[model samples]
Target chain A: MRRRIPQLVCGLFGLVTFLCYFSSHPIARKIYLTVTLDYWQIIFAFTLIVGALSFVRVNLRAVERGEDRPYKIVSLIGVVLMPILALIWGIRGGSPFMWVFENIQVPMQATVFSLLAFFVASASYRGFRARSLQAAILLGAALLILISRSSIGDLIWDRIPEAAEWVRSNPAMSARRAILIGIGLGSLTTSVRVLVGIERTWLGGEK
Target chain B: MDVGTLVAGLLTLAILTFLYRDNPIYKMAESLLIGVAIGYVLVVTWTNSLMALLFTPLFSRGELWLIVPFALGFLMFGRLHRRTAILSRIPIGVLIGSGAGVAIPAMLEARTLRQLSATVGPVFADGTVDISMVVVLLGVLSTLIYFYFSREQVGWWGRTARLGTWFLMIFFGTTFGYTVMSRMSTFIGRMEFLLSDFLRIIS
Candidate 1:
């Protein structure tokens, strides 16, 4: 009974929402907009709380187990401190909360992402070996694109940039479009399955 | 020197320290990042979403129907308890159903139909046989064929799929090259920040 009720609710909502897209009726449109804009936002807020609680639980357990205790403690402190700062000072552009965000968070994120450059370089060095036809083609294309984007391509040959652009717009774009179509079809099938109550993984384990 | 810039520089260096080796400083920075991210999200979600959308309308506008969603949102917390976990599935069901409902038509129209139309359209300009257009058309057709896993890739189909593989390789190589360029640009930006803003070594 527990599982069946949720599945029915899912199918009913799914059908209604799907119909709302096609229906020009004022009531249907209103319901669609309200469910999407208002209800979704509220649900997402609760989901965020759930996520935060999970984070606290995992890290607290780690700290209690004395596994990476110092770092876990530091993480917990940051989680606790930032919200308190926001609540007390507000998150206005010039507030301390924003300061920490702009200075600390932004810089940390950028630097971490920037580290990817080194990893990519190392990965390319190891993976871009030209032992076969496909490998040779891939290596050549990668090198050509990389060089064309840099000053060295213009220094070497004037037509390199044009060739790179042609490769990107022609073969690359076509392949990308094909992939998109496949994704679209797959997503549509999944949506239909969910709407019809054939897919119930979202309900979690059987209760 | 401003305290903000100094702190930013320190954090950036702490993160960059990971490139050398995983150490205590890097671990500390990583933990701090996760913590601050959660905190930031919590504040934004509470103030912008919960307060502005849920609370204001329910209280100020006296929208009694808002209670339904509020109750559903509250029920999501039942997930924390084993016995009442079944209650959480109702909200989860609705979220997935509504989300899937919204995505269906959009994906078909925007992704599949549009791409199909674009692929089958004119492969040349007026009075000119465009080579690029031919390549694009062939590439699209062959790639789609390659992705068809239901049938055996034999004879003509196999050769066509092989050609499609080459096209895919070129696409992936270009993507990787572009990604490398992007990451390099990011790296350069941080270097510029460190040199000019932090150290005052450049104008």
Candidate 2:
């Protein structure tokens, strides 16, 4: 009953949504909009909350196990504190919640991503080896782009930027278009599969 | 510096300490970042989605249809327990099913048909040979052919597929370069913040 019912619901919703696209009827439009906008967000928000609770549970478990308790506790505090702050002070500008977001969250996140710059540089040293023609081509393209984007490319040759632009617009664009087409077709098929209940993997193991 | 600047600068430095090695300071900041990010998302989702859509309409405005979503959303909490875990599948199924339905037409129209049309469109423009257009056409065709795994790749097909790899390589290289450059710029930005805001070393 559990497996069959969910599959039935999936097929029903999928079929309705698919049919709504060819439908200009107001009822269809209403159904489509309500599902896409309201229900999507509501359900998605619930999932996020569930995920947050699960994170808390995991951290609490770790703390119980004495595995990096301090860090886990810090994480727990962070998870617990933000919502409390938002609830009390509200998340508006000049609020504690916003303050944490702007100062603590934003700076830390930016620094974390920026730290990847060093790793990417280290990676390129290993990745840019040109033992094969393809490797050489890849290296050349990267170098061309890097140089063109920097201040020194115009010093070496004025056409470096133009050549880089040409490579991007023509060759790179072609590959991108092909990739997009592949993704589109893939998504279409998968959506159809989901509609037909062939993709019941989401229902989990053992029915 | 003000407290906000000082706190941000310190947190930024703490995160940057991973360059030396992964230590207590970096892990602390990383944990806090993850937790705080979740909290921020929770607040945002509650305010923007749950409260506004589900709660406001259903309770404040007396729109009864919202109970449907509320009930579905409540089912999501079933994931917390082993016995009730099966109930979560109903919401997941609905989300995935509707999402897939919406994606079908969108994927066909925007990604597939539009791209296909744009690729073939310019080549046929004015019946004149534009070198760039020709390159683009060749690139798209060869790349697609490379992805076609149904046939055994040999002879002319093999060569075409090989040409596709070169285009793919160029694409990868360009993307990698852009990513590195962007990250480098952000790193530079953090440095600027530290120097100008925190240390007052640079104007």
Candidate 3:
């Protein structure tokens, strides 16, 4: 009954949503809007909150077990502190919550992401071997783009950027379009499968 | 120095410490970043989504249908307990189904049909054969054929598929190059902050 009920719900909602697109009836449009906007947002928010709560629970358990105690505590402190700060001052601009977010979260996040550049450079150094035709083409394209984007390329050859732009707009764009089409078809099939109960993986195992 | 710059600078430096090697400081900064990011999301979701969408409508405006989503959302917490875990599937089903439903027409219109139309739109312009459009058409065709695995790839089909891969590689290379450049810019921004904002080495 548990599995059947959810499957029915999935199929029903999927059918309704899919049908709503073709229908201009006010109720259909309203249902579509309500489902997409309100219900989706509320459900998504709760999902996120649940995820954050789970993180806290897992970290608390770890702290209890004496695993990376100080770091876990620091994480827990950040988690706990932000809400309290928000509650006390609100998340308005220039509030303490925003202050922590701008200073602590944003900078750290940017720096961490920026760290990827060094890793990418090192990885490219090790892995970007051009021993084959395809590899050569890939390497050539990457080098062309890199050169075109920088000032040194213009100094070396003014048309380098133009050539890179041609590669980007024509061949690269065509391939990207093909991939998008493939993704579109794939999504359609997957959605249909889920709706039809063929893709019960979301139900999470054979209960 | 102002506290914001000082704190941001120190944390930024702490994160950059990971490049040297993962150390306690880097781990600490990473952990704090995760926690704070989650907390920020929680706050934003509560204020923007839960408060405005769900609570305001249900409590103030007395929208009764809003209760359905509230109940579905509440069911998501069933995931935390094994006994009640199956209840979570109902909400998951609704989310997936509705998302998939909307995506059906959206993907077809935007990704597939639009791309097809654009590709087949114009192969000639101003009384001359537009070479770029022709190439785009050929690229799209060859790429699609490359993915058609129903038949064995051999002869001319093999060649077209191989050409498709070259085009794909070009696309991938361009994407990689762009990503690297973006990250490089971010890295530059961080360096500027460290040098100009923090150390006052440059104005």
Q: What is the per-candidate TM-score for chain B?
A: 0.95, 0.97, 0.98
What residue pairs clash in candidate 2, if any at all? none
TM-score of chain A of each: 0.94, 0.96, 0.98
Off by over 4 Å in 3: none
Per-residue lDDT, model 3, residue A10, is 88
Best by DockQ: 2
Q: Write the per-residue lDDT of candidate 2 for residues A1-207, one digit (tens) a residue.
A: 989998888888988998997899999999999999999999999999999999999999999999999999999999999999999999989999999999999999999999999999998897679999889888988898999999899999999999999998889889989999999999999999989988888899966
Work out how many backbone clashes candidate 1 has: 0
Which runs of model 2 end up more than 4 angstroms from their true locations? B124-128
Error of 1 at A82 (Å): 1.5
| lDDT (Cα, tens digit) per residue for candidate 3, span B146-165 | 99999889999999999999
Docking class of 1: high
lDDT of each: 0.90, 0.92, 0.93
Better of 1 and 2 by DockQ: 2
lDDT of 1 by residue, B1-203 (tens): 89999999999999999999999999999999989989998999999999998899899999889998898899889888788889988888888889889889988999999998988766567988888878889998899999999989999998898888888888888998899899988999999999999999997
DockQ of each: 0.80, 0.86, 0.86
